[model samples]
Target: MYYEDPILKLEDFSLNIGNTKILKNLDLDIYPGEIILLYGPRNSGKSSLLRSFVHLNEELYNNVEGVGGIYFLGKSVFDLDRKYLRSQITYSDPTFVENLNFLTLKEILNLSLGLKLKDISKEYFSILEKLGISKIFSDLDNLKEYNSLKNWSIGEKISLITFISLARRPKVFIFDSILDHLDDFLLEDVKDILYRIKEDRTLIISTRNFSLFSDIAERVVFLDDGKISFAGKTESFIINYPK
Candidate 1:
């Protein structure tokens, strides 16, 4: 059997926030084409671990004291540029979507890709169609006239952000508590979209709603009080950590 190199590695990683130990000695190996479901209760350091990757060059990491480090593709995240690292490892938080209601869907996607809307290729349209949001794009002009996204439900906003993030086709997609806000129908759609796209990228979803994504997750990592309690195949995880 042949094993590919891990796309991301957290070696003895630890995090401290205001004298409280958030993540303690976390060592994880994430490979390409893997959908990892991070399961934990609130304040278990799921969001903190995910945010650390996004703010590799920010004060977030600088302020926190830790000996271990995160490595992307065998390179230390600390050595990479913030923008460059984010482009490869995109992070999305559903709560931030509503704040961006002023921007149209096209504008959001364009800004994510760093290109004008006109320059967007057929691939973008294909992704929208796959995610069942092509109609949203088709009616962009009419929708813009009314500032329609403002009226969208929380689920819709979450899905829109997920779609926009997917449009960028990042090497690693980090989703923080995105599934919790989604309804059953929308959740299934998003799961299907993740399955379709997981072949070419790594997906790290920090969600409390773990059972909903059990079928789609190749591996499950259970975090308890900032420590990884279990990390294994989905079936094994379910068997070991029975509800």
Candidate 2:
């Protein structure tokens, strides 16, 4: 008999921000091509743990301390280059846009790839078509937006952020659903996109809504007060989900 190794592994992992303890000695193994629905209440360290995977928390927070090992493909996360690791294990948070030149529809969409819109516009729209938001623009000229995000709908921003993250072509995708304002249709589109790609990549979606993306989550890991209260198959998760 043979067994496969987990793509990502957390061994007795813990995190601290300033004087606050965020994650408490977490241990889990994430296999490749797995769709993991990571959920918890607000400030339960979902974002902190996700950021830790790419080591984003250390750069943004001055008083951050993390212990234990976070490994990707048997390599210590600390041993890898931050930029390269980030590109490979992308963490997409809708509200936290890094180095934003201008939060235009075009620029936001092109945030990850950094290629001219003309070159990838055809490929871009095809991806958007799957998410049902492709009808907003017919050509590259329609990509400009001067008002940051004030003029655009919340749904549009969410969709574009989701798409931008996917364009990175990462091995592991960690998405933070910041703007929970998207309608049902958009959520379905996002779910479809995730399901379509899960065969080749690993996905971890952090959401407050239990019902959101439940259909695609093969496994559910629940975090409570920075501790994993439940980690099991989605079917058993329903029976064993912490109250």
Candidate 3:
């Protein structure tokens, strides 16, 4: 992925749902292989902005109206099929990944990779090793953890999203509510893994606290009251934002 042009671009984008406007004329450009951390307090429209990329807010709101456009790889995302758009621009929230609790490890991978368990077993197992979770999986075998997800750690569940993202290889990964559950140690490890996966993929992370991932994110964007309050390099943001 060369760095001449942005992989994703938003132009004067605005969103309206019934009686209220969620995003107001926001413009942004996301380059290839860039790690972007979007920060804002709750109800600041950070989630809505991310959702607009895949046109997800439309489904959630019946009176949705979008002004302006979002282009992905120079193509209008509006023109693409919903399913294909979602595949290319993967969106995951806290509740989204936690649903893996109902499915086994292999089952989750099967859905993401579109492969049969028998064929994908050995391959995905090696990926698990890279994540340093092979021991957990091996232990789970004894407990038949494959059949139940209740015993799974929250960080482990979140990793399944990362695992699937790695296997499927999407162009963009919009992760919302990722800073809440994971511990500092796991966050550090996940930061390394995220950098690996991001060699060819762009990341858009929604967080309330940017300091937690300040070291990992290359760029930072802040939204306030449905508008962009700040957009700049990570170092610049860190220096300027209130602690």
Candidate 4:
């Protein structure tokens, strides 16, 4: 489902940190609902580029050169309200953690929707059931609200973090190697959610594991040493890789 109009565009984008040139003259045009895979070895600037979009590193953000423009739904990312714009674009990673220990998954999700509890009981349970988290987290009735984030297991912590991002209904989701720890069943479930979301949103993921999503992604962009070496259909990546 390629958008005739691109939702995100970066032209001649470049970034530098502490006198090191990270990204050099990068250009990318992506449409909504299209799956873009960034395949590269370690330290190839894949994660750095993703972070630039979300404005995570202030050093990179301040020292960035060129346009480095990002358009979300035809509006400049810098033009949108910080909070509202952030909700439209979520940057996720399996190891990505800020804080989620004090609250349960339910509380975090509610917070994403303005922290309102009204008219949420039904929708909340329905999502939990679909994500296969109802059992472990238990039903909402048995759960207690959290006041802080601390002592969350790896799986529980990641799942809840992802749930918060999804609840925002972002139009574009950028993930950095999120499938690192997912098992087969859980991977498929996450894929199902992405596919459902792809019906209306664009998903960009960076991964070194190609086998995990062979038939799921539409296109793969190979990056090496901060440069785009190849861009083509997902099925053609291996065949195109130098032997």
Please state the error at residue 36 of candidate 2 in Å.
0.5
In candidate 3, how many Å is residue 192 off? 0.3
> What is the total number of backbone clashes in candidate 1?
0
C-alpha lDDT of all candidate models, in order: 0.80, 0.79, 0.80, 0.70
Candidate 1: RMSD to truth: 2.4
**Which lDDT tens digits does candidate 4 get at residues 1-243?**
453888887777777776788877787888877888888888898998887676665633565543466666677766777667667789877545555554544566566666543345656656656666655445344344332345455655556556666777788888788765666776777778877779678888888777776567888888888888877887687677852
For model 1 the local lDDT of residue 239 reads 79
The residue-by-residue lDDT of candidate 3 on 80-146, one tens digit each, is: 8888988888888887656877887666666778765446477677776665566655654643655
What's the TM for model 3?
A: 0.90
Clashing pairs in 4: 101-149, 101-150, 102-148, 102-149, 102-150
Scored against the true structure, residue 75 in model 4 reaches a CA lDDT of 73
Question: TM-score of model 1 relative to the true fold?
Answer: 0.89
Who is ahead in lDDT, 3 or 4? 3
Mark the regions of model 3 whose C-alpha exceeds 4 Å error after superposition: 1-3, 121-123, 130-132
lDDT per residue (tens digit) for residues 140-164 in model 2:
4455442255565666666766777
In candidate 3, which residue pairs get closer than 3 Å at backbone N, Cα or C atoms, i.e. clash?
none
lDDT, candidate 1, at 124? 75
> Which structure is stronger by TM-score: 3 or 4?
3
Per candidate, the number of residue pairs that clash is 0, 0, 0, 5
